[model samples]
Target chain A: SQTIHQWPATLVQPVGSPLSLECTVEGTSNPNLYWYRQAAGRGLQLLFYSVGIGQISSEVPQNLSASRPQDRQFILSSKKLLLSDSGFYLCAYEGADTQYFGPGTRLTVL
Target chain B: AQSVTQPDIHITVSEGASLELRCNYSYGATPYLFWYVQSPGQGLQLLLKYFSGDTLVQGIKGFEAEFKRSQSSFNLRKPSVHWSDAAEYFCAVAPSSGSARQLTFGSGTQLTVLP
Candidate 1:
């Protein structure tokens, strides 16, 4: 069975600080990876997705970026965090049609 | 562009009562529909999905949704609501596009089940 894992279940960052969130999938290769953000009481917004290593497609232009370094390792990073950037971050792997989610990371910018 | 619309922003129901949440979509052609649930501070879980064949699809957690092509709507239904079912529900549409396999999500509806 395939499983997804994300680190830093909760994070507290200062404004203008750098941020990194990691996501890795086990038992699956060549799976499509995605990074999404959910605003407070809002829907899930797609930030980036990678179909293969070194190929990242950004859905929404923001302060964050994504990179797929390995077949199952994807990372979400930010050069400088903004106050509005604080939210729940989710990493997902796509099956044939359905997408599976990770536990998600909560970042609070103070 | 293809999009999803979940009309209800919030729904409140008593435990053991019937439940129905409306979801409508705007797309040009046949599109795939999905329902997901998100608990507080947790990731979004796929509750159900509709591709073809059966109009009504059953999913985990005793949830079922019916797809109506004419109305472009996929409404989720449950025979009886439970306290555990209280969470945020999202309706998403997946257009048959390239290798991305991306999903466009709705604003979501927050369900509050009264005990």
Candidate 2:
């Protein structure tokens, strides 16, 4: 079975502060990784996805960006955070026919 | 572009009662449909999915969903509700044949199970 791990289960940051969240996958090789944001009382919005190392695709224009530094490691970063960037951040890897998610990181941008 | 629509914003069901949540999608071709459940402050757990074959698909947590192509709907149902089932439910869709495999999710429906 495959497992996805995300760091800093919860985070609190102020506007204009820099941010970085890491996601790692195990039990799989060269898997597709994705970053999604779920705003309060709203559905998820796709942020970014990576097919392989150094290959990243942005689903929507946003204040965040993603990078696949290693085959199993994906990082979401922001030079300066915004209040609108606050949300539940989810990391997912494409499984056999569907996607499996990580525990997620709850970020509060004050 | 593909999109998912979960009509209900919130629903309240009694424990042991039959439960059903509606979902609809819009796509030009065949789509891969999925339903996921999320507990508060947690990630999403797959409930079931409809890729092809049988219209009725069984999933974890005693939940099932039927795909109605004509109606462009894939509604989720459970024989009986459990208090533990209280959480937000999301419906998603992706192109059957796409390299990106990007899934577009519905707004989601918050399920509130009452005792």
Candidate 3:
């Protein structure tokens, strides 16, 4: 069975600090990866997605960026974080017709 | 452009009661639909999906949804709600053809199961 993993289950950072969140999928190759942010009690906003290595698509213009270094490794990064950048970050990989999500990382910017 | 609308922002039901959550979408072509559940402060979990074939699809945790083309709706239903069912439910749509399969999600419906 395939499983997805995300690091730093919870993060606290000062505004303008750099940010990096990692996501990896085991037991699957060449899978579609995505990054999404969700505000408290709000819908999810797709930030970026990658179909393959070195290929990333931005769904919305923002302070964050995503990269696919390896086939199943995806990273979400930011040179400088904003107060608005703090939210629950989710990493998902596409299956036949559905997307599976990781445990997620809760980011808090002060 | 594809968009999804989950009309009800919050729904409260008693345990063991039938539950239904409304979802509507707008797309140029046949859309790929999905339902997800998220616990408080957790990632969204895929409950079910509809790609092709049968309009009615069963998903995990005894949940099912029906895709109505004419209505442009994919509503989720459960025969008997459980206390564990209390969570935020999201309806999403994926672009049929795209380099990025990122989904467009609805605002989400918060389900509250009362005892």
Q: What TM-scores do the predictions have?
A: 0.97, 0.98, 0.96
Give chain A TM for each model in order: 0.97, 0.97, 0.97
**Alpha carbon lDDT at B45, candidate 2:** 94
lDDT of 2 by residue, A7-77 (tens): 98999999999999999999999998999999976679889999999999998998898999999999999
Question: Residue-wise lDDT of candidate 3 within A29-100, one digit each (tens)?
Answer: 899998999887656988888889999988889888898999999999999999998899999998785789
lDDT of 3 at B19: 98
Q: Please tell me how candidate 2 rates in CAPRI terms.
A: medium
TM-score of the second chain, each candidate in turn, equals 0.97, 0.98, 0.97
Candidate 3: residue A69 lDDT (0-100): 91
> Which lDDT tens digits does candidate 1 get at residues A49-92?
99999999999878898999999999999999999999999999
Interface RMSD of 3: 1.5
* Model 1: per-residue Cα lDDT over B64-101, one tens digit each: 99999999999999999999999999999887667877
Off by over 4 Å in 3: none
Name every residue pair that clashes in candidate 2: none
Supply every candidate's count of residue pairs whose N, Cα or C atoms clash at under 3 angstroms.
0, 0, 0
- Give the Å error, residue B16, model 2: 0.6
DockQ of each: 0.79, 0.77, 0.75
Ranking by DockQ: 1, 2, 3
Q: Write the per-residue lDDT of candidate 3 for residues B8-88, one digit (tens) a residue.
A: 999999999999999999999987899999999788888999998999999999999999999999999999999999999
lDDT of each: 0.92, 0.93, 0.92
